[model samples]
Target: MTERAYFDELYASSPDPWDLAARAYELRKYDLTVASLPRARYRRAFEPGCSVGLLTRLLVERCDEVVASDLVAAPLVLAAERAPAATFRRGGVPDDWPPGRLDLVVLSELLYYLSAADRAATIERARESLDPGGHLVAVHWRHPFVEAACDGDTAHAEIRRDPTWRVLVEHVEPDFRLEVLERGAD
Candidate 1:
């Protein structure tokens, strides 16, 4: 599990540490993410590492219900305030896997922070919880960062290697990579 202190300190310093709410890059990426979804409406969706719920707000319009979570409670507080309809929780991935199978799971700007082993475990958990024909959308920054354990290419490569998932959409930019994958109905 990621240390709470790290995220706690992050939120203590700034409300939107990654500029998730204000950055034009993030706004465009969020737009692309929501657009990439094949289905117009989903019964249920899950978004882990939902910082301030910027994407969650968009997802709420497309999903009948959404469960968004983060490792620290601070961001979730803001997220809940912003999107009261979406359930917000303070929890990490894999270990804190949510209840019920999800038709859509969004992993945006979150995977690179985990070690390789944890990252793999998180993907596996996502696969396990995904309903048949469910969607898994992953988006991450491509550049190297001292705080990040892996790059966007590396994270998406791992996701592509999973046999159970079929790539549906791939978008690449100088700054980031976004991929939409669907779990096989079988």
Candidate 2:
């Protein structure tokens, strides 16, 4: 199945398909994601696959403006309802990418859904979209899943290989891996 179809099907049956809002594991993950940021506040932030806007709500507290997107419209509706202030759109990454340079770009539990070529393109677009000294944060489940194209660790390893980004922080837990990367001056 295509990534879009898979996500659409997953959300078609359930609102909180991943239990992202109620799960203790997800809450902890969100906490760590916010904590891992080097800066307390950001001018503008972009969050892709902002499922139910759970993380988007948290991001709005620290960001002056936030632009969030999802491939399926189901979650985007919930996200819009949850965080009406945010600019919510229906589009997938690396193709339906948002315009303008961003100070913070977040890829959380989203990259593994993409094929290798799409994933690499997404990372490349992110690198190009970020302003100098901007931040890029990625968080993903560490374990293997039958549906995922690649494990989180492998995806992160590929992301780190980009010379334009410098790894600033890496948090490893039994459940997930989180990395904070800054766009390099060079």
- The TM-scores of all predictions, comma-separated, are 0.96, 0.97
What lDDT does model 1 reach? 0.90
Per residue, candidate 1 scores C-alpha lDDT tens digits across 1-186 of: 346788899999999998888889789889999999999999999999998999999999999999999998888888998888899878888689889989999999899888899899989888888998999999999997887888889999998897879999999999989899999866
**lDDT for each residue of candidate 2 in 1-186, tens digit (9 for 90 to 100):** 146778878998999898999999999899889988999899999999898999998899889999999888889888998888899989989799889979999999989888999999999888888888999999999988988889999999999897778899999998899999999875
Backbone clashes under 3 angstroms, per model: 0, 0
Task: After the best TM-score superposition of candidate 1, give how far the Cα of residue 6 lies from its true spot, in angstroms.
Answer: 1.7
As for candidate 2, its clashing pairs are none
RMSD of 1: 1.2
Off by over 4 Å in 1: none
TM-score, predicted candidate 2 vs. hidden true structure: 0.97
Model 2: CA > 4 A from native = none
| Backbone collision tally, model 2 | 0
Q: Give the C-alpha miss distance for residue 141 in model 2, angstroms.
A: 0.4
Error of 1 at 81 (Å): 1.6
- Reference-based lDDT, each prediction: 0.90, 0.90
